[model samples]
Target: MPVISYELPDRFVAGAVGQPGERAFYLQARSGRRVTSVALEKFQVTLLAERLEELLDEVRRRGGDDAPVPAATPSELLDDEPLDQPVEEEFRVGTMALAWDPEGEQVVIEAQEATEGESAEPEVGDDDPAIAVLRVRITAAQARAFAERALKVVAAGRPPCPLCGNPLDTAGHVCPRQNGYLG
Candidate 1:
């Protein structure tokens, strides 16, 4: 089975290769010794950042700054490692789950592969060929940094179509809003 490490990540960020729709996004987390990378769609990265911000707001509203998260700027927290080499994916993530751990004051991110359908029984232990889950624990400060950097990476891609909200290409895009005509 493939190994999924459970530890506090010192560096965590969502990065992509290519442009917009053609982009291949990856969720990467690195500790002192280990680096874990998982392939996911660009939309997944966007949604994760959005949901994490909402969770953080809710926590702050309910708890009233009890933990007092340290101030961390995005530049100070970015992962410096090149995503090109020595970063083989553990799995292609199919489902994602995120939660805030109140007791630990940490954000927990989990990504899992698509499982068998309801009609199929799940395999166990040696019967299962690969580990399908990746989980990482990160601080709230790190969460903010991650969110900021993720948005920058996403926005650096192609501009969006004003009418349909889909990314527009340099050559142009056929927007559905305009009845499938290039706008």
Candidate 2:
């Protein structure tokens, strides 16, 4: 969700007579990026910005503009008062950091350097890799997609458990995945 540009075309005159001209613009959204062109008369351009503002206002009121991805939760976990903190899960590839969230189901995949003591700022670029965080209410199809992508990414590397930082070499373990009973 970046504001790539906000400018008027040079060909279109602000107060020109005759038929109204057309204008084009660019906007980049999260799901995908697109270049949109609008054909409007000179008078329409001024109104366009205001109209867009009003439309955005309405969208905000309806909670449709920039709506956050809802996190997933088990039915039993949806009590009035949550008993425990949100679980912290980490998927790793080699020594690079991927996505991270304190709470919520949205998985953000972006590359960030590991600072020895403090949280390092993410490096900005077109080629940076990302980690996807899944929500509790994510559907089976969505979950499968997330898992598949993560597998493809981590498959080329080994991941260490977040708790013990031990490499999960095989299926044998008494960790959290084993229910802690050590059967």
Task: Name the candidate that leads on TM-score.
Answer: 1
Per-residue lDDT over 1-183 for candidate 1, one digit per residue giving the tens place of the 0 to 100 score: 553756677678888876566888888887776778899877888998888787777777777757445434456676544464466777787667788888889888877765655233332121334547777788888888888778777787888888988888888899998898889
Clash numbers, per candidate: 0, 8
- Whole-model lDDT, model 2: 0.28
Candidate 2: list runs displaced more than 4 Å.
Answer: 1-30, 34-112, 118-143, 156-183
Candidate 2 lDDT score at position 90: 30
Residue pairs with clashing backbones, model 2: 20-41, 72-136, 72-137, 105-135, 107-133, 109-130, 109-131, 110-130
Error of 1 at 176 (Å): 1.7
Question: Using Cα atoms with residue i matched to residue i, what is each candidate's TM-score against the true structure?
Answer: 0.82, 0.18
Question: Candidate 1, 92: how far from true, in Å?
Answer: 0.6
Displacement of residue 66 (Cα, Å) in model 1 is 2.0
Candidate 1 collision pairs:
none
